[model samples]
Target: MLRTTEQKRKYIQATRSQNYQASLKLEGITTTAQTTQQSKAEILQKYKKYSQPES
Candidate 1:
């Protein structure tokens, strides 16, 4: 079956994302909801220093 260029691009992008996710799972680096939240908080905390208003 012939796919349009857009269709082919979408399929390739989806496949690449799926493969990247699968690889992350294989490497035991998948982020759960809790871990995701924690990472977000940690990131915010880490970068908070630069957000201070000038005195």
Candidate 2:
């Protein structure tokens, strides 16, 4: 329903702003692990192993 250019820009900005509100989200993740000496997949897999329920 956004017919005007200004309205479209406002709608797009509003939608993108919602994505930036990470503190309100449930599962917020960070890329700080990527700066570490460990590889990306290795760190993720380690967390994945700990997150799972034991058999």
Candidate No. with top lDDT:
1
lDDT of candidate 1? 0.76
Model 1 clash tally, residue pairs: 0
Task: Put down candidate 1 lDDT per residue, 1-55, tens digits, no spaces.
Answer: 5379998898898789778778889999965533233677788887897798879
Q: Which ranges in model 1 have alpha carbons more than 4 Å from their true place?
A: 32-55
For residue 19, model 1's alpha carbon misses the true position, in angstroms, by 0.1
lDDT of all predictions, in order shown? 0.76, 0.73
lDDT string for model 2 (1-55, tens) is 9999999999998777566555435466543312246888999999999999998
CA deviation > 4 Å runs, candidate 2: 23-55
TM-score list, all predictions: 0.54, 0.40
Residue 51, candidate 2: alpha-carbon lDDT: 100
Measured over all alpha carbons after superposition, the RMSD of each candidate to the real structure, in angstroms, is 7.0, 9.5
